[model samples]
Target: MNQLPKESIIKLQSHINKEVVIQFQGGRQVKGTLLSFDNQLNLVLDEVRELPSQRILGLVICRGALINSFAIDGMVEIENPYI
Candidate 1:
């Protein structure tokens, strides 16, 4: 085949799991593994870790309310078996 098969190629989906740091419009920060997304470009993240205290934060608002700006760190490059 000149191209790839049904599942031979890895698809990054290129949606929510795009690894991004969204600065919600509420003056808050969110960091997590993109769990899912919606048509409105809203994200459902898993393994989420919040800054300030490095604690886990649940679902949050995605409105561009208090947002100043956002940034993407990048894919995690470390592997520590013990947390």
Candidate 2:
């Protein structure tokens, strides 16, 4: 079984229980509180809501393959190792 890199795990761990915005393929997006995630980047989120419309979705398990990107609800400055 391939394991996730330590840095990735640490980054995700910091976001647990925090509000996040997940953008999916085809431009769909949602906001929710991150509950859990796996090596594949698949996520379990609570209090999920669709973006723009703000429709309540309650809870969701999102497949990593469909995910385009993830953003914390607020500004987060990631250190740039090369800079």
Candidate 3:
């Protein structure tokens, strides 16, 4: 199994329990609180809701292979490395 990069793990750790938006293959999107994640990129989310339609899905476990992309909800300020 391919291991997650250290930077990616740190970023995910920072987003734990925060709201996130996940886009799955075939163009489905969901919004929820990030509960946990694994090196495979598999995720466990709570209070999930389908995007656009706002249908509630409660808790969900998303397969890493099916995830297209994901972004943390709202603005996140990154420390400027060049500062």
Candidate 4:
């Protein structure tokens, strides 16, 4: 993978107080808070957001869960909660 530009990294870090959609290996997708991320690319999420009515996931964790995705989550919209 090519290195992301510093500007993009800064932008992502600044947008921490947001929700993100994560897709797992089995075509499951979920939405939740982006609590934290480590240098190794692991994510700690919390208070999972309301998911799409059309999609159903096998599991959900409110406090937080570790997620490993192929890429950083896209722009998310959160109505409540401060990052």
Candidate 5:
């Protein structure tokens, strides 16, 4: 894999443990807490939920290639007893 640009690395680091909504092709969207990412922009998320239907997905890894765009999670309160 090619080396990730410094700005991309910094952006990913800042979003670690934060929530984000990743929108992919074909109108699919996934929302979850950002767990980890790589130079490829592949993402691992916890407490994931598929959009529209809002199905609760425990964990998921989204392929960077399939990702079209992503939005930083807004001011929605997340209730997690265990920090």
Candidate 6:
């Protein structure tokens, strides 16, 4: 298999440990702390929360295929309260 070029990566990895909002294909959105990601854009997030209802989903792995777009959630700090 051919290796992905460094610049070809989506650049999400740089945001690790930060809060992010992911928009899915069907208008669904999820917000969480970005734990990690891969070349395919698959995301591992902690403290996941669904929008609107504000439901908690804990840790989750979001497939890249279902992701329409994503971004860092505002300028708010998302540090764990308990430390």
Candidate 1 residue pairs in backbone clash:
25-65, 25-66, 25-67, 26-66
* lDDT score of residue 36 within candidate 5: 94
The local distance difference test score of model 4 is 0.52
lDDT tens per residue, model 5, 1-83: 89955656337888899889988988898899999998889999999999878999979999998998878955356699897
Best prediction by lDDT: 2
Per-model lDDT: 0.55, 0.90, 0.88, 0.52, 0.86, 0.86
List model 2 lDDT by residue over 21-80, tens digit each.
Answer: 999999999999999999888999999999989999999999998998899865476899
Please provide TM-scores, in order, for all candidate models, with all chains considered together.
0.49, 0.77, 0.76, 0.46, 0.75, 0.77
Show where candidate 2 strays beyond 4 Å: 1-10, 74-83
**Tens-digit per-residue lDDT, 34-67, candidate 4:** 6665554455556554346644343344221344
Q: Model 6 segments beyond 4 Å from truth?
A: 1-6, 75-83
Error of 2 at 62 (Å): 0.6
- In model 6, which residue pairs have backbone atoms overlapping below 3 Å? none
lDDT of 1 by residue, 1-83 (tens): 49853451323255455555655655566676665644434556666667656687765545433445445564355688798
Clashing pairs in 3: none
Regions of candidate 3 where Cα sits further than 4 Å from its true position: 1-10, 74-83
Q: How many clashing residue pairs, candidate 2?
A: 0
